[model samples]
Target: MDIKKEWIHFIENSTEQEQEALQVFLNSLKMKRERKSLTHIASLLQLKTNLVEDKMLEMEMPNSPLLDNSIGIVHGGLTATLLDTAMGTMASLVPGNKRGAVTVELKVDFLTPGTGEKFICRAEVVHNGRQLVRMEGKVRNEKGVLIASATGTFFKLAD
Candidate 1:
């Protein structure tokens, strides 16, 4: 069967709780499909925050099995991706920044297991230059328990 049909079949066989979980994943997928942008996929996974120009960028996401690892905590790769995203978002807001930045390097320290109802990340630009931006970010739970910390360098593209 095709992927869509297979998804329907799986949903039909799943318990209500499982179906609800699947729905969350499907909702994000649907929104990304509608927007037709990878950026939209990132936005779908995150909640809005006070991430304005030249200010700290914050992003949050709810606890969902779709983002969890085999042991039920958020996956490390996802945590790193979110960290990078937070930094990049802040980089884009730097003064005189004519273009958005792409990750040149990202280093994350998984300080603790990511466990909570929601994950929150906050980032700020440490150094904004013409060609490179450096940012630092931290991820915590809703209860303010630190999960990870990251520092990243992003390369600014030409206008």
Candidate 2:
């Protein structure tokens, strides 16, 4: 069967929890399709960019099974992705003749297991230079425990 037909057949036989997960994925895709202003990955991940200003960015994402690992906690890569995205946003928004920026390198330290109902990432530019920006970010769970920390370097894109 084709993709759509296969999806229908699979979802029809899925458990309630599986159906919910599929629905969330579908909604993520729908959000990306409906909003051209948001990045596809951000939309796909259902992350909300709460703040984006010069030298700082803050974002949040729901803690659900969709993003969890086999061991029942948030995946390390997802946590790193959140930190990277936040740092990149802050780096790109640096003041004084800045342009878009792309990540040159990212180093993430997983401090503790990511748990809780909601996760937040906060990033700030540690040093802003003519062509390179250095940023640091922290990820915390809903109860305010640090889950991970990251530092990233970004190179400014041309005008």
Candidate 3:
């Protein structure tokens, strides 16, 4: 397909808001390409895994306009995504784990509007069963205000 042609036509007819949306789309693609070796979702969210300690993980992401919704706040879905990532990482990175895990179920509770320069997400492994893992996660603003809390269940991969 002629992506250049479609882009030219879009550029000619797009409004200011549409252009902004296009910018965000392009940035997401760029991030996905750059972080392909790691994780596309992490790149899209610009998440930094700042800590990986025993049965826990800590990460951070900026509250960018690209991640904002119509109200100029971080979208709830993105918040959930970060929590999921944190919990999943905790499950996968546990010591002597021969295989990773996939989330089987997730539950999120949004506590407040997500507004801040950045977000801090932390996850702890609540239980590590032979075939399933349970995790708890919390997302907070830079000011340490809780934004959302979550629980996740992951199914461990068979070795």
Collision count for each candidate, in order: 0, 0, 0
2 or 3, greater by TM-score = 2
Writing each residue's lDDT as its tens digit, candidate 2 over 38-135 gives 77678657788766666677889887668889999999999999998888877777775356789999999999998999899999889988889998
Please give the RMSD to the true structure for each candidate, in Å: 2.2, 1.6, 2.6
What lDDT tens digits, residue by residue, belong to model 3 across residues 1-159? Answer: 499999999899998877876776677678788764277668767788856678888989887667888988889999999999989988887654568989999999999999999999999999998888999999999999999999999988878
- Structure candidate 2, residue pairs in collision: none
Q: Which scores greater on lDDT, model 1 or model 2?
A: 2
Q: How do all the candidates rank in terms of TM-score, highest first?
A: 2, 1, 3
* lDDT for 51 (candidate 1): 70
TM-score of each: 0.88, 0.92, 0.82
Model 3 Cα displacement at 86 (Å)? 0.9
- Scored by CA lDDT, what does every candidate get? 0.83, 0.85, 0.86
Worst 10 residues of 3 by lDDT: 35-44
lDDT of 1: 0.83
Deviation of model 1 at 36, angstroms: 10
